[model samples]
Target: MQNPATTAFVSDFAELPATASHGPLRIEYRWVNEAAGNAPIAVFLHEGLGSVAMWRDWPQALCERLGMRGLVYSRPGYGLSTPREHAVKWPVDFMTAQARDILPALFGVLDIDMQARKRMWVIGHSDGGSIALLYAALHPDALAGAVVIAPHIFVEDLSVESIAQTKALYETTDLRSKLSRYHSDVDSAFYGWNDIWLNAAFREWRIVDELAAIKQALLAVQGHDDNYGTMAQIDTIGERVPHAQLVKLDACGHSPHRDAPDALNEAIAAFISRQRR
Candidate 1:
């Protein structure tokens, strides 16, 4: 069968009633290599301010290289998905809510049978990385493995500092305008992620305890020069999840897929192959 990733796929939306209380959310997703025959499915999760469009062609490229099927989606309040209620502030456990509630609802709406497709894997970046880790922890039996890029297992001073700087740039520069092209509601997307991270109460936020429950294989990756977080994030994963592999790329920043796509793709392809065997 021909690889779906070779060409662009039209975006489809999934209405999730479980998140209706916050706002009506329709998750935007696209399939890559959908006809790759029973190969393991790799689900792509985007970063804090990321959307399906922001991911560009990286997911498709990676899936094509690995001969795998792919599902790339935008979470609520991102990309072409639902916009957040302007009055609502994301809670500290927002990532938990995403893993436990939003994602499952999305999968059900899309009819992805994790039980039948036991080799399903999650490839996540930044905030999505954390969400993927949380999902693997909560549903250990559902996933084959996970690849987390620049994931945050705990709040860090550097993260807070960089986030604060972003807030400043959003106000003074054209950052908001640039991001508007990707998100329908720029403020909702930006503040929803920014406010919580900058909140003093969030400093205590940590998911290290949750990592111990993840029985599936895991590969934690981060850039050596990542300004948003330090190596401790992946280090903590290795410390907790003894079987987890760590990769630190040199001269790369927060977004490894953008900065070092070739290296990131190779690492993920190899990790998934090893785990599947």
Candidate 2:
């Protein structure tokens, strides 16, 4: 991992106009290889309950390896970004809202021109992976390709069971304390994801139709031992997208970027290089 002291990334904050009754939100973002002039840019989207800080040095490491610029940011309810108001329940289409609304707003604020950029990529993990898929679908011509790690195409029974266990651990264990280290408002991040998943209506959440609309190059990766999802997630993506590639890692779990960083980085770097060529 690159040391923070010598890393070339700059962390900053942007104020984005609120889409609803909440006031303007502050989004925490980091720019990697900002001086790499006109090179392809890869945007890293974190998992549910993830923040810019939670991604640690992975984005920088991957960008450095690929010789590309990177943009990493915390969603509204994560990291130092704006926290959701108290008692606000995320809607069933929360991921859609993010892909269709918040992300475009952020890209505009950051001055990233999707139309002009020839090699723009979206690298997303878990919930972020789902969001990336949604984004690519919504704006098919805007992306060169996408890398989705441990993404969910549909809600699964195992997902609900594991999420339930997580809720138990959050209440009865030190999980909340540990999570507090990564998020400024832990509850805002946690319940925003957790409640939505466990909600009765969320059981019907699925993105298969959205996946069909994505025409860009796609690489879908998941761990063989993932507790949050199964190979079926990526398999279904391939089934729907037709050209999507699937990678399943052994001895890995939901968080492949953490559990298998070297392998994941190599796979993604190679995939991006090929797509660019």
Candidate 3:
């Protein structure tokens, strides 16, 4: 892995105009393997603290392996897109809003054709994974399949504890400094995610019921040693979405792409191939 502090996070990025209930906004995005013009499109959603740059070269690698084009971006309050207000707090339904409002709007702004939409697949991690599930539930026919890694269907004590520890690390250690390289407004990116997860009201947050509404091919992946969440996360997904394929990786952690790239890629590629057949 490259030293984030010394390396450039995002080398080249494009901006698109998007409207939110709050107002008009700019979204920063990048295309991977654009030369695979007629291939399937893979849309990647990052973790709670992740950005386009944080994904590093993994999207490119996966797209190449799958013969798919890729779309990667930073959501508001993360990366270079837009920053959240210091005084504003994210609603408990924030992830839902992202899936229901933000994602579709981005697709519209990008003018992704219906043909492309039919072959679209979403690959998300952590918070992004939860959003992907919500989007699949809300728009069952919009995507062909989805891959959720270490998603949070419900708030867990383990999750809160990990996030709380991260907060302390950000305050006392160089964690903030390291993360700043990936975001335009570091505080906006950090606090927006941190404050909400730690909020007492967010303890009951869960999307278990929504799982039943998803009709697309789904693959849920989790790690045995994940500090932020446990096997129950993907296990519940399997319970709710009976057709969903579940992968439990040993000697892996919260971030599978980083922790076990080859295994993760192989599982995703096989699942997607099966869906096509």
Top model by TM-score, which number? 3
RMSD of each: 4.1, 3.5, 2.7
TM-score of each: 0.94, 0.93, 0.95
Q: Give candidate 1 regions above 4 Å deviation.
A: 1-9, 19-24
Predictions in order: lDDT: 0.87, 0.87, 0.90
Instruction: Give the best candidate by lDDT.
Output: 3
Q: Per-residue lDDT for 86-141 in model 2, tens only?
A: 59999998999888888888888888885644468999999999999999999888
After superposing candidate 2 on the true structure, give the runs of residues whose Cα lies further than 4 Å from its correct spot: 1-10, 20-23, 115-118
Candidates 2 and 3 compared by TM-score, better number: 3
Tens digits of per-residue lDDT, candidate 3, 1-277, equal 2234522544443344545465566677888988898898999999999988889999999999999999998888888777898999999999999899888888888888877887999999999999999999998888999999999999999999999999999999999998988888899999999999999999999999999999999999999989999999999999999999999998999999999998999999999989988
lDDT of 3 at 82: 71
Q: Which model is ahead, 1 or 3, in terms of lDDT?
A: 3
lDDT string, candidate 1, 1-277, tens digits: 2123312446788887754545557788888877787777888989999988788889888988888898998888777788787888888999998998888787888888867446788899999999999999998888888999999999989999999999999999999988887777889999999999998889999999999999989999999999999999999999999999999999899999999988988888888778657
Pairs of residues at least 3 apart in sequence or in different chains that clash in candidate 2:
none
